[model samples]
Target: MSVPILKQGDVLIASIQSALTDRDLLQLKDELAEKVGRLRSRGVVIDVTALDVMDSFATRTIRSIAAATRLRGAETVVVGIQPEVAIALVELGLTLDGIATALDLEEGLDVLVEVMEARRRDR
Candidate 1:
């Protein structure tokens, strides 16, 4: 199923609630990029609180989404990673690297807002 992507002011929020296939990730990337451009979004928050598995494909797909959004001038923040998922990701040698992360959706939104504001001030 396609994930729900919502718009909150200038930020786009995508919450993943089930296991995702390769197709889902690709669709998400496309939809997010389209939304960011159409809405002129300044930030994005991807909430994975309900996701139980964090495989290599999922990791790479998320990072790809972040990078694509960044290229469109929107910062991305991932939120709601469970403890086990975190450990699994680490054991699998997967690090999020340049992507920003938060403990929960609320925090993720806050982080995105802060980063966007900082960027605005820098210009």
Candidate 2:
């Protein structure tokens, strides 16, 4: 299934509504990367609240999505990772290194704002 990616000001929010296949994940990564550049987005929020399970491939793809968007100058935040999913990822030794995470969409956006503000201060 195709994920719905919404643009909120300078941020792109991809809310995964259901379980996705590897192909779907890759497509999401590609689409978000392209949108980050095309829309001049400064941040991205990926909401995985609905997903009950996340395998290594899903975890890796999500990480790659963040990495790919970062290369396009957007900071990515993953929000709403279920408790069970988080535990499974840790058990599998799949880490979401170099990525920011939040409890929900609101918190995720706040994180993005802080990150953007920090960048502005640095500049």
Candidate 3:
């Protein structure tokens, strides 16, 4: 139950294998903060497709993770949401609306790289 971090064309990609709950949220928060800090660029991708269920704790933890990343001046893109989870979230009217999501890792990376490239151009 840990998050694995990798680098791809200046983007930081992270995959979490643990169920998100209060008991594990603290560890996740700590590790994610550290990993985001270590990233070489401001673009990051968080893949949670393996997550079986998303409760309030899970939702809030992901929000926290996104916030933490943003605070470090990094942008987070979530990818690979299970179809059932998507339907559940919609049915429940859950608001993960503020966070950016992509269809898959490839799409997520494309979005990240596009945004990063835009930022580079602006700089």
Measured by lDDT, the strongest candidate is: 1
Quantify all predictions' global Cα lDDT against the true fold. 0.94, 0.93, 0.76
After superposition, the stretches of candidate 3 with alpha carbons farther than 4 Å from their true spots are 18-21, 117-123
After superposition, which runs of candidate 2 have C-alpha atoms over 4 Å from their true positions?
A: none
Tens digits of per-residue lDDT for model 2, 25-110: 99999999999999999999999999999998998898888888888898999999999989988899987987899999999999
Each model's number of backbone clashes?
0, 0, 0
Q: Show the colliding residue pairs in model 2.
A: none
Compute the lDDT of residue 40 as modeled in candidate 3.
50
lDDT of 3 by residue, 1-123 (tens): 556678776567877676655766667667767766775558788888887677777777778887887787667788988898888877877768668889888999888777667756876
Residue-level lDDT of model 1, residues 10-113, one tens digit each, is 99999998989999989999999999999999999999999999899989999999999999999999999999999999898898998999999899988998
Instruction: Please provide the root mean square deviation of candidate 1 (C-alpha atoms, Å).
Output: 0.9
